[model samples]
Target: MKLAQRTALVTGAGSGIGRAIALCFAREGAAVAVNDIRRDRAEAVAQEIRALGRETLTLPADVSDSVEVRAIFEQLTAQWQRLDILVNNAGIVELEPSRQQRLIQAHMERLAGSGAPAPLAISQSITDMEWRRTLAVHLDGTFYCTREALKLMEAQRYGKIINMASVAGLTGLAGAAAYSAAKAGIIGLTKAIAREAIHCGVYVNAIAPGFIDTPMLAEMDAEMKRLIALQAPIGRFGTPEEVAAVALHLASDDSSYTVGQVLSPNGGFYM
Candidate 1:
């Protein structure tokens, strides 16, 4: 019960990594606030915690929407008054390797042949909706949620913020440009926040997981799955529980001395 009597808000807690983190924290005795864009999913997770004899609050809101993110915090304040931990873990990944490669190659060719301004023509092959949507869900959501969390944390002079980055961010995954870019932004945000809040006892950090056996990896074919597992020197993909363990450490007082660190549990994939 490392988190006994603590209060935490985990976004996207309806499924996958977020769900695992929520359950793990609840087992460790944290009164968790389970958040998901879906009301039903949020309620389900909240119920699971209650069954464990832990207090819980279900927050159903799209974190990508700034308005909803603010309201979620307001609701949390009414229940707990203060927050001890926050895990910004909501994200989406689209598996379109060929499409991603096409965009990247086209972008590179244009940059080389036309001396084009990089920012003006970034990934023309990718649609505006796809790019914006991915960033909105991951990067924008993190910023909005963190902005709100910082208010409560800075005032109290103690808080833990754990962001969900991916190995794609550390070493761009060929088929996941948008996801990789968004996660990379999260890593940068964590470092900046850690530095800014260093004197306030608000520790910010990120976890970069590699090929975890979660819903994100469910759609891959057997061959693709095999390749993914073998990509890691450990000869297997990781588990959500394994990733949750790292969250426990970062969200606890044990990480008081750590700041803006991006912890990678990649099974020796990237070194």
Candidate 2:
């Protein structure tokens, strides 16, 4: 019951890491807000939380949209009057290099045929749209939620914000330029907010996960899976529960003195 009587909002709670965090928070005695773009999935998580005798709110919205974000917060504010914790864990990944390239090329070709002048060829390094969307969902979404949540947190002079980053943010991957750049931005933003919030009794921190056996990792090929397993010092991918445990620690009083730190549950991949 580390989070007893607290209220928490978690984005991307439909499945994977986000769902795990939502469930963990609820089990620890928090009134959980489970948000996801898919209505059914979000409600499913909410239903499970209720079955556990925890108060829950199911909010379905795209975090990238400002209007929906504002509405979600308004509902939360009206219900709880205060938000104790905010976990920005919603994310998407693009893993297939060849298919990604082809998709980008086809999109450009379509736009060109539609009479919109075609831009330059898509760069193998990173396409403009990919960079934009990555930043929008990861970096921009974090900023939007943190900014909105801080207003309420500041009033109470007590709050915790846990952002989900990744090892790719710390170490670049060949085909993950956009994702890596966005996550790197999150690390920088987390530090900046932590400094400002410390004076007001708020803590802002991030978690950089590596090769978690979530749905995202399941999309990888056998070769990629073998490579990741071989690379990890523990010789296995981490589980969503393992990463969620660290998030729970950060969100609770146990991490009262910890701020602006990126906790990596990466199984010694980088170290």
Each model's lDDT: 0.89, 0.88
Candidate 2 similarity to native, TM-score: 0.90
Q: Per-residue lDDT tens digits of candidate 2, residues 93-185?
A: 877656445445555578578665444333465667777888899998999899999999988999999999999899975467788888999
- Residue-wise C-alpha lDDT for candidate 1, range 1-271, written one tens digit per residue: 7999899999999988898999999999999999999899899989999998999999999999999999999999998999999999998877665554455555556758865433423345568888999999999999999999999999999899999999989999765678889999999999999999878988999999998888776766565677668779999998999999999999988787889999999999888
Provide TM-scores for the models. Answer: 0.90, 0.90
Which stretches of model 1 miss by more than 4 angstroms?
97-124
Q: Clashes in model 2: which pairs?
A: none
Give per-residue lDDT, candidate 1, residue 71: 98
For candidate 1, report its TM-score.
0.90
